[model samples]
Target: MPTTALQDQLERGVAALGLALPAGAVQRLLDYRALLERWNAAYNLTAVRDPAEQVTRHLLDSLAILPYVQGDTLADLGTGPGLPGIPLAIAAPGRQVLLVDSNGKKVRFLREAIRALKLEGVQAVQSRVEDVPGQFDCITARAFASLADMLAWGGRLLAPRGVWLAMKGQAPDEELPGVPAGFAVRAVHALAVPGLAARRHLVVLGRDTA
Candidate 1:
């Protein structure tokens, strides 16, 4: 499919899920994706190369967790090619998004995408999840780490009343018990990504009690 057509289709798909995205931002996302595909051949930044899959799997998967993201300032850990973070920023232009990843190459790709898209309210930073500076209202991870490790190494990055939105497959049943005492796990809602083979869950983790 042509890039413009695919872009329109993506907007329709997202709207079908009750999420409305701005037309210019959708076009920017499509342009960014096109650039990403071209760069992926040499950068090896992402495993997902197919254009259609990029929409349903990567883009949609990210937006599906939008409601769960609790703050104006958000951090996306292990944000390879800015999965949920970039897409989320595109969808919600008002939210400030920091895309953090340890891999220098992936961070480079993210920087390039940000410039290419001329995206507002987006920043790319290179750092480990644990050592990343500043606090965030919400932190997101996709195929980044086990829930246990996220709470361990990355938990401190969240603001005092922040939430953690994790996109994972199969619900991660065995991992819930290991969260730190302050953090509690709740609301495992299935995601509705089209053409996705595995079951997706938007796992919500948070700590509001002192």
Candidate 2:
């Protein structure tokens, strides 16, 4: 698809999501997508190939959870090619975003994207999720792992009052029972991503105070 069409699709999707992004966020998002596409050709960053599909499955799909995102610090665990992390940073500029992944190639692409897009507060770290230190007010895991395992590995990074946003294709009802102790399901939202029809859900979890 042409760049203009992709922009149109992204704009409509953002509007449908009821998000009013920064003035140039839409264009910057497209630029990020282009970078991902180019890198994916050589490094195989993501499974999705087509550019239009990238907008639907990657860009809009990531932006779908924007409304639920909170706090000034966000850590995207298993951020392969910076899925929701990069898009979220583009849409919400001021928040500090940390994209973590063990894959060196993916991290390299993420760094290039951050620099090319001039995303000031974003940083890419090539490391396992468990070893990434520091607490974040919001944490995103995009189809990275089962809820049980994700919490077991990176749960420590979530602030006492922070939220964990787990993006999944379907509601992980079976995994709810396996959520490790000290964390509870706050809510589960069915995301409606534009230009694509697929089951998408965001499982919100928080530290269990009681």
- Per-residue CA lDDT of model 1 for 52-106, tens digit only, reads 8888887777778876767789999989889889988888888789998888988
Q: How many pairs of residues collide in each model?
A: 0, 0
Candidate 2: 10-residue stretch with minimal lDDT: 189-198
Candidate 1 ranges beyond 4 A from true positions:
208-210
User: For each candidate, what TM-score against the reference?
Assistant: 0.94, 0.98
Report the poorest 10 consecutive residues by lDDT, candidate 1.
16-25
* Top TM-score prediction, candidate number: 2
Q: Write the per-residue lDDT of candidate 2 for residues 70-117, one digit (tens) a residue.
A: 999999999999989999999888999999999999999999999899
Clashing pairs in 1: none
lDDT scores of the candidates, listed in order:
0.83, 0.94
